[model samples]
Target: MPSRSCPRLALLALAATLALASPPAARACSVCGCGDPQLDASDPAAASGRFRLQLASEYLSMDAGTEGAPGSTDHLKQVSLRADAVWSPAEWLSLLARVPYVRKDLTTTGPGAQGPGSSLSGLGDAELGARITLLSRVDLGRGRSHGLALTGGASLPTGSNDARRGGERLDEHGQLGTGSFGPYAGLHYAFSQGDWYAFASVTGRFHTVNGFGYQYGEALLWTAEAQYRLGQRVAVSLGLDGREAWADLDHGLAVESTGGLVLAASPAAYLSVGGGMWLGVRAQLPFYARLRGEQSVGPVLVGGVQYQAL
Candidate 1:
């Protein structure tokens, strides 16, 4: 009887050990909206749902001089903070919201010297939108996938337009808040492997200015990015962006382009650190810039954090 009891106890212990050694299922990839498309489709873990949040900040400064004052020049500085959250309900559906806070200051000198002057404050504008993946990897081919996403949304007028205008009247084009309805759209494509990823997308927005007197017609924007995994926990990317804006008021339209490199390190599977730069065209132009022969260019720095909830 003692020998029979010992055999039963040994069997139970072996079964428990096997169960503890099995790995947990992989959580979905909510950060990119579309899961890693480069992985095998038969893997159940690749189709799971995920939630993501991201926060980013940027700083920019520009200075220009005129021939009359020779040494005299004008300068502007701007700081921006942005946050985004997204929920993936299905492999083909996602909802997103974004908020932005901005601060700006301007200084000028020459004949009418007003001494050095500055204004520092916030300009409020927040946006909400939804995105749908019309096509997934399954629709493309076996082992290969392509995703099509369409986003629609609006920006709420929340920033103060009168924060620091100094004594000079604010131009409608210079005000921070549009005080009117704005619409935007985006399209994206991604190709993924077990852990590597590449993507490209284009986004556009149309703005109808409010009583403040600015006219922002329609703008076209586009971006392309490629990324590779350094190991199981790190990924780095390079990207380029281009934009053309049409002004309805005095500042006509301006064309700007930017290119940058991004470095992202995932200490854990769900958290990441990212930083990049915008090395290209930066400008504020009067509608008829081409006619006036005026152009502005500069560089910007950007940094951010991303968190995903499994």
Candidate 2:
């Protein structure tokens, strides 16, 4: 209950929140940090109850595979508006909520996009979550710190899953949501010294079968990032991410090309603007992909503007 303990406790909660939030893996699905978390970090105007809003444009495209495969290649071009609010009602706890609006166009190549394609434009699944400070930071002089935290949350099935065009069902991948609820848990650890900082996190998400009696499989995601602050307004981050996914199931049958493991690298830059505002851009590229079948993964580009203390 001491006045100085509040900021240290908030720093502990941040350790967990920043772990899985900076550059999520490319195939993390429900566990990806598609919204920016560090968007309004450490703004003097943001004493408590900080809010960060990010609107980003993201794009990803796949490659064509061999013939006779059950699925064909597809490319996704999307524009999404994501909003994240961070409220520190108590020093030892924080509440977070994220909502996104996605407009994605799927273009099929070869046989896949020719028939099983559909456009999705609507509200994506919204997530409500909270972070607890398991370990508060010890703020030594000269800005040295260490902290840890834990996070738990769930996603609501707000997006439509049964989207059809001309009486044909679109692919599950193209749907705005899985039509199923999911739960997420994660842990974070971070260390910072002066202008240099590093963080790591492990996150897991499990999903249930959707309305079509199909499940997209569970995912375990890992992330690590090293960053350096430039002057007072700029930060550069280099991140590595990995994901392991179980094979998807449909009608109790395993989907061959549905799951595997992927490793990716991402780099980002953030520029702080005056009045608790910032701008950022990041790219996620999969360098190693060992999928189950003939599936492939690609890169994602995200550009966003964020605000805090609002």
Candidate 3:
């Protein structure tokens, strides 16, 4: 039988997973850029749990820089609803999948614009992946442990690539999907000593050209955080997350303003509501952004719930 004390570790893992998985939907650029892969320190082999589910929502609003025309208003607001599932079939391995529903509103300030804004809602790209624990150590008497794992996955082009508004074709960046497949790989490490925990990871996503002869830039994503368990039912964390990307390619030509670097401060809290359920919220405030050409970025807010089913 799995230990009921697992909720403490389960809550930590839930908060960590939510923080890592929410950023990909928060970007204001053409490509989804970068975000953390879904993996954490919870040890299923240690009698934590065998299966879990998470539901989360992410929100971001951004304004474009004045590059094309004077007195032009280009702003974007996006909200994503994501459902993630994790299954631990073996002690050393975990399999996961994610599905997303996206809604976007783009408002432009310009002459001859179609209405005040355009809105689109649809299913986004879905992902499938696994995590392999490479090493695990535990000291039962000291209540200290650490683990290292390898994580990788791919995103499927399940959403529509070509979307039109007012009979006008939307730009690739404005489309609901990339229309191409993406593969990603990363490494994760976590350490816990008593009520204090630390985590870090780096992931890279490789992009391919779509049928439209457009390829999004490859992205590098990373995160580092520290969490403190206040008691059996509460925890708080603070960390830094960031991304770097190469310029995107369009018909073998680099697209201007398509790639850059962004770094943010993340603070989060989690609470156990009892019966294997946990609630968490995180805020990502971009303190630094440097983009090519004319582009701007904004903060992201995320909230979610996790349930341990098995």
Candidate 4:
């Protein structure tokens, strides 16, 4: 154990460095919601006529790290906290609502460490949806079963609009809201047997023109996940998700470098406590980004606590 200390220390040092690194400047984007594990809407663990409340936090850093301030840098950062509530009216139907608060920071250095930095923080769009289990678990004989579900939702424009700084409007990434309503639909499938589980989902968001005459591109999202139960109190999961967004439109015309595809990998873990309480954490890395122009999105880290009726 004595020899392991050095490697651990090195890793910590690297993480610290990454934390301080500034990310490239980008527009504020609240479209990317919390990296919730996309679990089955109709959780088998919860009985019908129950409520589940989940609270979560996330943070991400972007751009290049600087040893210290005093040099020019272009980076962005995001932090958010969210609450998700689910109500199951019956075994096959669930209603969901998600509310989030977000804070965004961007730094664009001019000369030395003395550069321009922009900050925006406020409530994000709220989402309301319903999920129905079209097919519940079907025993395949041999400790195996599968389920299917459908989900539909809408996002309300309830946050502050972009703030003008000296005759310039900060991009969407800098604004608190899109100033438009968004609607979405999705399908979910799950399979489980013994200690292993698998899930897949496909979702799409249809964006509408906001008050600013700008609209984020429509987004198509999909996720595939697999999990393994380690003992009774612990479960670990891995998933990959991809998003393809059509180019954003400004004044009804496509904006340069406004749309493309982004793919990420998520590794997560859950710890169950007594009384139907649990803790979950997940990390996402954007391994692939294909955009029209110069664009960048930071990594995302998520942690949450939840309580469900047994």
Ranking by lDDT: 3, 4, 2, 1
TM-score of each: 0.63, 0.82, 0.88, 0.81
- What TM-score does candidate 2 get on C-alpha atoms? 0.82
- RMSD for all candidates, in order, please: 15.1, 5.2, 3.1, 9.1
lDDT of 4: 0.62
Candidate 4 per-residue C-alpha lDDT over 23-47 given as tens digits, one digit per residue, 9 for 90 to 100: 1123323463322223425244434
Q: Judged by TM-score, which candidate is best?
A: 3
For each predicted model, how many residue pairs clash, with residues at least 3 apart or on different chains? Answer: 8, 1, 1, 16
Candidate 2, superposed: residue stretches over 4 Å from native: 1-47, 63-71, 111-116, 139-142
Q: Write the per-residue lDDT of candidate 2 for residues 182-278, one digit (tens) a residue.
A: 7877786767665567677777877888889988678777777777666566667777877777877788887655567777787777775666556
Per-residue CA lDDT of model 1 for 1-310, tens digit only, reads: 1222221121111110100010101000000111111111111111237565556565555443422244454455667676666566676666656666767565656663355555555644666676667676642233344566665666677755553345765423234555666677767666554334445556566666565454444545544444444442333444444444443332333312111111111111111232211111111111111211122334444455544455
lDDT of 4 at 36: 23
- After aligning candidate 1 to the native by TM-score, how far in Å is the CA of 191 from where it should be? 2.1
Instruction: Please write out the lDDT profile of model 3 over residues 31-56, one tens digit for every residue.
Output: 44444655433333223357878888
**Displacement of the residue 108 alpha carbon in candidate 4, Å:** 3.6
lDDT of all predictions, in order shown? 0.40, 0.60, 0.70, 0.62
Considering TM-score, which of the candidate structures 2 and 4 is the better prediction for this target? 2
TM-score-sorted candidate list, best first: 3, 2, 4, 1
Off by over 4 Å in 3: 1-10, 13-35, 39-49, 65-73, 111-115
- Regions more than 4 Å wrong, model 4: 1-29, 32-42, 62-74, 109-115, 166-169
